[model samples]
Target: MGFGHANAGYRRLFESDGLTFGAGFPLTGANRSSPDVDAEIRLAKHAESVGFDALWARDVPTYWPRFGDAGQTFDTWPWLTHVAANTDDVALGTSSVVLPLRHPIHVAKSAATVDRLSEGRLVLGVASGDRDPEYSAFGVDPDSRDEAFRHRFEAIRACWREEYPERESEWGSLEGDLDVVPKPTTETLPLLPTGNARQSREWIADNGDGWLFYHLPESTLESYIADWRELAGAKPFVIAVRVAFADDPTAEPEHLHLGYRAGVEWFREYFARLEGYGLDHVIVGLEDDDAERALSTFADDIVGEF
Candidate 1:
């Protein structure tokens, strides 16, 4: 099997024709504050039990007071390890790991460790650093991240797929003498670059195993999928949305941040429309105050309906 195709997690989550759903982490309503880790874990297990295809984790290395979102309030690597150990059979994903902020060696090693320990359940979403404050904090030049992203991406793939591969780049030099330990269960870990990562569409098509993007309107999504087909040809496309489900099954759509507030009936229709546009997967951010109830409702009504 090829690089991305060999990974069991990628296959289970993205290889199918119809759309699938994943529950985003920090499974609580708290955004600007630290989440209750015990409750979040319970919800993650419950999410898998109720048939969520995957569980998504976000990488927010630092808490920026200005940004106002702490992003699950956990380091991604250890957090994923915890989730992987506690859950069974659900794909574990980094909604994105900011590549330009960390060394590719560390990223590659940690990803491989998680993939191996999970028995092939890790899907790595790579991105250029988005928070402006984070770049300077990490001592990276924000303006040069386009170059850094490409270099780090290449380095990570090399570390995973090659045995002591001879390579030299800004990140580091591998002299073909010592191999990176705990290589992935597959030839290479599946990489889904998030939102182009400051690269051209052609670069994205050529490099990424798949593409992870933000939610766009239906008409725009259709056009984007059409263009993607023309460039990448069946490589999976994934998106995330912040959804708030109402009690009434027939409630109308109300716009929110990056998603909508709607009834289960409206969600069924909206997701079907996304499937028609050739979307492979969606990671849903459940925004309801009652997290468990919202997840249960979505699973029983919206997920199965599609």
Candidate 2:
């Protein structure tokens, strides 16, 4: 029932109980696709010092200009390995790599590489993908993604858990003659299936080390948490929230796309309620431009709640 939380990476962000807060890529300063790499690394270092439980990177394979988000502008594995090289004690995560678009063998190899290099500080988030343009570009059929996602998931796990484990999939197969080198620091990697990945809720509850859900309204989130508790038992549930800090500490919620535009005190109360509802961790995407100050304030106020 504990799944992949046995590893240090999952443990860094989640405890046996309570909630923790994390921040995603691009920090605050050079927060764009063409951000300064040096500065971003520095920001990562500083972010850990200021107390973010995890640092996440998105897995956007191509730039869908119409979609309007380039996602960190770096490949997930190398960038995460680079960040792992720089930071100490902070968990490194992939917000959700697109499983339908890539080969599972490569993903397994790359994920294991980062896990080994970081000494077990990687939490992999995987998804079936939602981008319309990406399907054709990657030569994958949109309707078939559901199956692809499932197969890729199985393939990746097989590569990690079995040495040259013979497994067949739509992506490809291992015949037990060839093996993916360098297993994860632990026996297996912690894989959190983000969104549905086009699988049933039960499949996610059964397979994922955790569930990476999107931000929802308070009432809706509460209902989902109740359902998750009934289905998943003690497995962790994580959500990504978009936040914009307001000047007033007590300002009321001005709901943005995914999160609220409010003061830290208000956010503190909001997250406290989330934790109470059985949410284990939050990955915040700061909408405000002041990254350092916002991080510091969030660490002091909202993160301090757990």
Candidate 3:
């Protein structure tokens, strides 16, 4: 299979008529937390078994106490590969890999390796670096991140799609002599530019396979999707949302950071509304003490509706 219709990860998320769902990694609830690696793998497998469409790993190079979120607390590539080994079909995703601080060649090789190993079940969510301190640590100027992000994005695409690509970039030049080995399971990986990635809407439409945005109110989302449809046609629109299930099935929705607090019934209605508004996929963040029960309930209650 090639890049578009046949890419396993992209197909799973973007196919059909309604929204698909994914679970973000380090499914822990507390701040700056990293649970046992074995438990994480088990939960990942459980998420897949219960019918989540994807599993996302975040890129947090260093743990900053001020940020208060450890973001999976593992490097993306190996963690993804390890998850791939255990779970069969769930798409392995990076919640958004910061491109400015890292070299594209390494990104290219590592991402392609995961895709090849996972049989095309990798989808990349690329982003401009978020933290100012990370930029200082990496010796990359925050202002230059705009250009650096674009260059790195292009370079990674080249490495995946071409044999010995002759490319010049701020980081390094490919002289067309050495190839980045183990090309993707498809012609190239699917790139979802995460939260603009310091790019214009036109650039995202021209380049990204999809757009991964943060959560917003439904009215606001309708406006965003309208703009996206105008600029990007039917390209997928994805978001990360936090959800909490109340003990009462009919409990009404209350506002939470980036999402809502409610019972499964209200969530069912909420997600159905999202699908109606042309939203393509949702990355689910659950804060539950009983992980297995939470995933099982979500799969049966919320996911089954869509």
Candidate 3 lDDT for residue 53 = 96
For candidate 2, the per-residue lDDT at 305 reads 59
Better of 2 and 3 by lDDT: 3
RMSD in order of candidates: 1.4, 1.4, 1.6
| Tens digit per residue, CA lDDT, model 1, 249-303 | 8999999979999988999899988998999899999988789999999999878
Residue 132 alpha-carbon offset, candidate 3, angstroms: 1.3
Off by over 4 Å in 1: 1-4
Q: For candidate 3, write residues 148-222 as lDDT tens digits.
A: 999999999999889999999789899999999889888888988999788998999889888999999899989
Q: Could you give candidate 2's per-residue lDDT for residues 52-161 as a string of tens digits?
A: 88999999888887877878988999999999999988999999899999899999999999998998999999998888999999899999999999898988888888
- Order the candidate numbers by lDDT, best to worst: 1, 3, 2
Question: How big is the positional error of residue 2 in model 2, measured in Å on the Cα after superposition?
Answer: 5.3
How much lDDT does each candidate structure score? 0.89, 0.86, 0.88
Q: Which stretches of candidate 3 lie over 4 Å from their true place?
A: 1-6
Specify the poorest-scoring 10-residue window by lDDT in model 1. 1-10
Model 2, residue pairs in steric clash: none
The alpha-carbon deviation from the true structure for residue 83 of candidate 2, after best TM-score superposition, in angstroms, is 0.4
